[model samples]
Target: MSHTATPPPAMPPKLAEIVDEFASAPRDVVLEMLLEYSDAVPPLPETMTDRAGMEQVPECQTAFFLRVEVAADRTVTTWFDCPPEAPTTRAFAGILAEGLTGAGADQVLAVPDDLYQRMGLAQAISPLRVRGGTAILARLKRQVREQIG
Candidate 1:
């Protein structure tokens, strides 16, 4: 069953690798990969460590806070505040931060809403968790638009 809203286009190189790697992995290994991504989520920068500076995602069961910035040159950077205990939430944050970092504001905006469907994670993770992935992207793009527009 196709979960993508449209034919998925080629993503940024780093993102494409992460998605493609998961798409081909067996169900048993998907969780392992997600845990790896959770580990890859860098610690929150000292400036953004405070909850007030970051926006919390109500859609997520865990406390997932994020900040998306578009620089004067239009380079996008994303940050996350998810705990180590919440691997699933942290994995989603990590994926977004890794995928969207260095991307242009327009590129980040062009990303589809139902991206997790294309990532082949639905079978391994809960529907709510997958939706949280899309929500993170949506919120990040919104923040980017607010910053650069």
Candidate 2:
């Protein structure tokens, strides 16, 4: 009897895009890459008692993964690899904040939750799909830093 071989699962378009963007970046850049990618397409945050474990919520999705290993005083380094179906506006801030804390960052560099909510534009932060390149993601991060910080 002949058996047909099954094809491997396809990589999420968003993930492939993210890997291409920062595959060769430095640790900090990689952290930024992850945050940007996740903010664009965040995997759901996992729930847990411990903060670190709670951090796993987003990373567990087929969309993203976080790798943090650095040596710097009060330096935050968080990396997230997200699927293609995540939101990108207000959620991005929360995702980034959780990632920063999860990765041992002292604090997040984005806007505060209360302030963002006060603006009444939370729902607009829909998840972004990585279609063109990571440059867009990088640019968005810059904007977020400027507006929030």
User: Whose lDDT is greatest here?
Assistant: 1
Which structure among the candidates has the greatest TM-score? 1
Kindly list the per-residue Cα lDDT of model 2 for residues 16-106, writing each as its tens digit.
3333444445545544444453454333345311234212223222333333333345344434443455433223433443434432222
- lDDT score, residue 30, model 1? 88
The residue-by-residue lDDT of candidate 1 on 79-143, one tens digit each, is: 88988899998988888778876888777777767677777888889999988888888898899
RMSD of each: 6.1, 18.1
Residue range with the least summed lDDT across 10 consecutive positions in model 2: 126-135
Q: TM-score of every model?
A: 0.87, 0.28
Full-model lDDT, candidate 2:
0.35
